[model samples]
Target: MNTDFLKVLFEISEALVTEELAALKFLSLDHVPRRKLEAIQEPKAFFEVLQEKDLIGVGNLFFLKELLYRICRIDLLTSLGSSREQMERELRILGRALVSAYRQLLYRIAEDLTPEDVANVKFLLQKLLPKNKLQEDASMLQIFLEMEIKEIIKEDNLEFLKDLFQRVRPDIKKKIEAYEGKRKENYSREEVRYPVSVQPEEKGAEGGAAKEHGKIYKMKNNPHGYCLILNNYIFKNPSYNREGTLQDGEAVKQVFTWLQFETVEYMDLERKDICDTVKEYSRKDHRNMDCFVCFIFSHGEKGKIKGVDDECVNIEDLVSCFTGTNCPSLAGKPKVFIIQACQGSEPHPSVKVEPDCSGHLEVDASPLTSIPDKADILIGLATVEDCVCFRSHETGSVYIQSLCEKMRLLCPLGVDLTSILTEVNNEVAGKELEGYKQMPKITSTLLKRLVFKVPQ
Candidate 1:
């Protein structure tokens, strides 16, 4: 090893805490064996093991950067002369991210839980884990490592963890479901892209040959799925009428129809009607369909959207209608919900300078965390939590219109739904909307890349 590389490693090792070292070791389990990692206590010895395994070296530092990034030690990344953006860009290429997304998911769940939640989890797992492993000070990461050693929760097997969480933390259980959905989606994609040669006729072909295509959601049905639009244009209160919402509805309809979805729009629905409509779709036989999508253009308050009758419906309740238990046919499939409503009453402050067409803008009220904690569900909000999203009196809202335009331009090129939404986010965020700004938010538990196939 180069002296310079050794110096860099020394600096990085000094910065990592005990918990972070444990985390780095856990993340490296796929590369290095568990027994080898168990013998390594300090960061220096761990680095030496990684070097011996040929996982990291002076010239090859990608794995080193990944380990630091995985532990969220971005500050320590400068020692490697790397930035977060650089790591993200490199990782976007398929297979560059050596760490499995499944492993990352578990690590994230560990990070999200509080100390009390961790303790609760340990208490609940008393029967499964040994007494020493379930000690008072054992971190969630350590507990998870123990679980893996006992084959309780592996990348493919999360049911055991899911069942345990249901008894302790139901919310975390939903996260596991989301992870499982994504894993299945990825597995299917791999199977499709790289099929195993079981036939005798294919025995002459080269071994390990695989397609270079990325994983995409299967969209093969005639009418791919329902694209329901609940457009609230005229409220019972005359002053609350949404002027340009019809344009949003029309744009969504045109794009989804072009994509071959069974697009339908409902005008000025009351609160009860909105709930009923979502539930009605949830009850429909979607066995033949590939996905389900819904769009809501309405005024609202925190955690709820308003109806034409000025009554409010909880967004969470509406989203939960399509959960696996409620809508079994659509289980393991994508359920997308796009809302063109302000998450809150405050306009986002702006610093950039670019003027767009001026028009009367209105605010819808709601909080950001309205989506249900279920797998294969994605909620695209018009704005961030506690911030306002703008709608033009002339054209449609910035978010919905940009989303439609990007989908039209990118879907034909095979861009996935999340990437298209990200483009919309960039477009909308760049525009100076009436001296303010709007940053769209995407909350997704989608398992795979949802690439809509355009009809021939």
Candidate 2:
């Protein structure tokens, strides 16, 4: 709506019409019928200005808007929890506008790739839909748009994007599969491909609520002793993803389901302000008081975590809430946090890292807890400051995957909680990313050693 903010984009788009010589590699790709991305290799001054504009303020907002527009436009609406028609139309208009704007900016920048700008675009796009299942939606157009962008541009802003994806990937991926399924049904002439649908073992997940509070219980109900799950998204406005809206509230559904405390799945609630759904479920279940195991995944700023309204919740909110002095249910039971986002706004001016098979190097080996405590709590982070967390175009969170892997092997072996997390940290650190590795962090305060299972 703010034309001033958008004016720069229209100006940059104009050069795309007139014949301009392509220079760099990002530009050489034939992405769309009308839109072609060429590398902008020269004009350091121009690029400097471009980068400067890309920093923060009007330009950043425009970038965010256009980026969101492109994602909504390309993901092509699908049916899951919402309507396809509505999402489709919105994507069409937005898709066209974003490409037009994107191309215009590219041309204006003389067709060279702006690393930050392009990285930002890629990051936002990753959030828009399922990056791994780009072809699932009947969105050959958006795919082309992204492909043109993806192949040419190499970026480093992916950690933020990966954190975001870890949070919303389930809903977004499910939509992509639905979109592909529908495309096959409606437009049988076209080919369709889908990603692997990795669902949790139904036994523990489908089981109902937990029954005790202070008392540590076994899987009298099912195999999963605890479920540490986190679904963090900035649900401030209607979702621009077209297919559906991501409500902070759905956390309630997950929380309630996860409340089957006897069966743990390691989902944490790092996001401070949960949706109405989450709150309502908590109230009804009230089971969290009996026996608590909750993990949060959300935006963090040092000791502070993000709430729905940009409010920050201290990291200890998760554990302290259930401390013996506070809520009686979790007086000393294990409370876990599996965070996957930034901890603060500080600029971690470290060395630019080489990409490894694991995606990044361990910036530091500092432990999550510099000191030890007696309260039973465990914490895990995706990465250190400003570093990109590796995402599987195939699996979900590397940290989580490692956690589950460790759980599967150790739980049956009666591995204690600390030992299991130790293995997680070691496995992550041992991962050879061109010899560099990601050292995961963990902090625990437990009086009783939590062995996943007892010896036969």
Candidate 3:
């Protein structure tokens, strides 16, 4: 290597902390083997290994830039004559980002956690790791490495880590959820780009069937479609105010906007106004659009949800407004209805386990049979029939927040709408809240995979 290049590497090495060195090594596992990385303890030696592997050189500093970016040491990129914006633009190309998003997510969680949080995490893993490895001062990155070595937490298998985080740090657990969402999306895209061969029976069951019934739905419009959010927060009854519902509205708006949808949210809509708004959108000229989405957040009783005036609106009525017969302009296009309300007044029982948050949960009632008997329609309910859903007075309803998170993470990777709802179901069902659980339900009659095309 050139003298100046060597000096620059040395300077960058000196700038990295011990935890960052470990992160750099972990991120480079795809390039360098784990056994070789385990022997290198210091940053300088790690850089030497990178040099031996031909990852960094006089003219090539791409991998080095990726490593620094993964560890969030963008300031050190200045030493290598690169800026954060330049690296971002270059990494936008496919296959240019060497580090896996999974590894980066773990490293980010490690960086965000405080020292006390690390200690608590280590304490939780006392039975899993060697006593010597779980010393008083062991870092979170080191604990992660030990977990990886023991095959407890792999890139694909993160349930153990997620469970642990739910106990000590729920916020960090959310980071994992977001990562899984994005990872699933990328996997779906990869399957589309580079399909693998399968056995005849398997192909008939999965691939052949997909080809027989069209591969993916058409979504070529500039603004792909409309995302209508019917958020009912305040009500005529003083006790019916839906606290923290605005958070859900804002979350959906942000995600759909990023997905190139014309997101419009109407807060505190009365029963008549809600029906009128749905009819207005259904009558529009949707020839230039690809799909339609609606989100209803409110309180109610079985088979219905309440409007701002404490009047009940049948969930089926809102969904029927966009049916093929009612709205011919949007015929054969996917129409999604997401309801963040309880299906009944009964609390779903679960095995005794620690809860995720301390905030109180209130319930809203509705039915699961909200979708009409029609094609290209889907209804996502917060909970199963006769079961209650949960909402945090501080955050939003569990179902809406999880759904938005999954959409924001997965849509760009081309995951279909139904598959994304499945993920949302898993995430919401996993939560234990105040001695009760919520299981989301999905009812769909779509004929083809409705994979959204994310805007660039």
Candidate 4:
């Protein structure tokens, strides 16, 4: 490296430290160590202290570097007499040194990373490792690092992780179980704890080719799967009903059809009809397809969505019909549910608008049947729980319209489903009617990336 380049590196490193302190201030983290922030001015000394304190591991440092790069890149471009590519090449070289520090830190505390830290490290590894590195190596740590971030943060479930560890690293698995045995449910919220391992694949044979980086297996020629839509637009009791849902159902059908899904549209289904239809469809052979989707458009109250006859159907009961146990054909396969309905009776606070600036659960009760852990399921709600979902009678609900638009555009660009959903959420959330607002929420247990290939 040239002496001038070295000087720029040092300056940028110091600037990163300063930006970090500014970020802490903005985030209002009052207890951040002052000495630590000061030490970052001296790169070598800062890393030394980091290792001594076990503050952050290699993966985390990479993320911080990423943040630092975003913050200081424009300044670096103007100040350093180097091309953008050249600057990136040099920064990557320096990043390797940070990775080296992470490895040393990892040795000092191999199993001590928090779940969030593990997540950050996993992202770094994905960036740094050769493509197919995880696929080529199925060892315990490698597999654990490759699992989904959602799996790491799942609530009150360690069985999946334990099983995976037991299969690969029995010694560590034993220790984990022993610790778990002694633990009580009640504990201080601030205490640090070891992260649980990840669940092993339920169907190992299905994803061999998809193990490649940035690629997923998509069904060829054949329609991927069913788009089961329950459009309860015309209710027997007009007071407990919705309009514009017919249009929403048609919009969903068109989008999914373009996506190569065989759309099965239903309308005016009573509560029993909804249950019967879901069960019937779930029983069919989905082995030939890559995934499944179900969309419901109806009026609903908290925890219960209404059918055409104005009867209440518990949302959980409807969803539970397609769980891994109930829908064995779809086990280990993706099942997506997009629900467009009011989750409660209360409307969002709305104000009168000027024409110009546009904006801008279920119950089930008896018999004590156990609900299986939901895996391979992705649910996207129009509105959050206990909130009214709005519709434009002539157009469609805001969520479906935004979602279909995003799916039409992004799906062809090879964007994964979750990322597309995120964009959909942003688009809907940014929209405003008078003062009313909406933000969609996506809760997923999908293990593989789902990408639709729109034929040219």
Task: Give all candidates' CA lDDT scores.
Answer: 0.81, 0.38, 0.79, 0.56
Provide the global lDDT of candidate 2 against the true structure. Answer: 0.38
Q: Ten-residue segment with the worst summed lDDT in candidate 4?
A: 360-369
Clashing pairs in 4: none
User: What tens digits encode model 3's per-residue C-alpha lDDT throughout 1-456?
Assistant: 357668888898888887778778878886689899999989989988887765565444667887887667879976665677767765664434667777777778888899899889888998999999999877777788899899999989899989999999998888899999988998887677434323233445457745554556677787989999999998998788888687677667767776788999998989899889999999998999999998989888778878889888888887888889999988999998888998888998887754454467777766655568899998889999898988877557888877876665466555677888887897677678888888999999888787777655
Error of model 1, residue 269, in angstroms: 0.9
lDDT of 3: 0.79
CA RMSD of all predictions? 20.9, 20.4, 16.8, 20.2
Candidates 3 and 4, the one with greater TM-score? 3
Candidate 1 stretches greater than 4 Å from native: 1-214
Ranked candidates, highest TM-score first: 3, 1, 4, 2
The alpha-carbon deviation from the true structure for residue 432 of candidate 3, after best TM-score superposition, in angstroms, is 0.5
Best by lDDT: 1
Runs off by more than 4 Å, candidate 4: 1-218, 347-372
Clashing pairs in 1: 182-447, 343-366
lDDT of 4 by residue, 156-187 (tens): 44565556445544565565555455343322
- For TM-score, the strongest prediction is 3
lDDT of 1: 0.81
lDDT string, candidate 2, 141-187, tens digits? 33334544555321222333334334444443344344446444733
Give the TM-scores of the predictions, in the order they appear: 0.54, 0.38, 0.59, 0.50
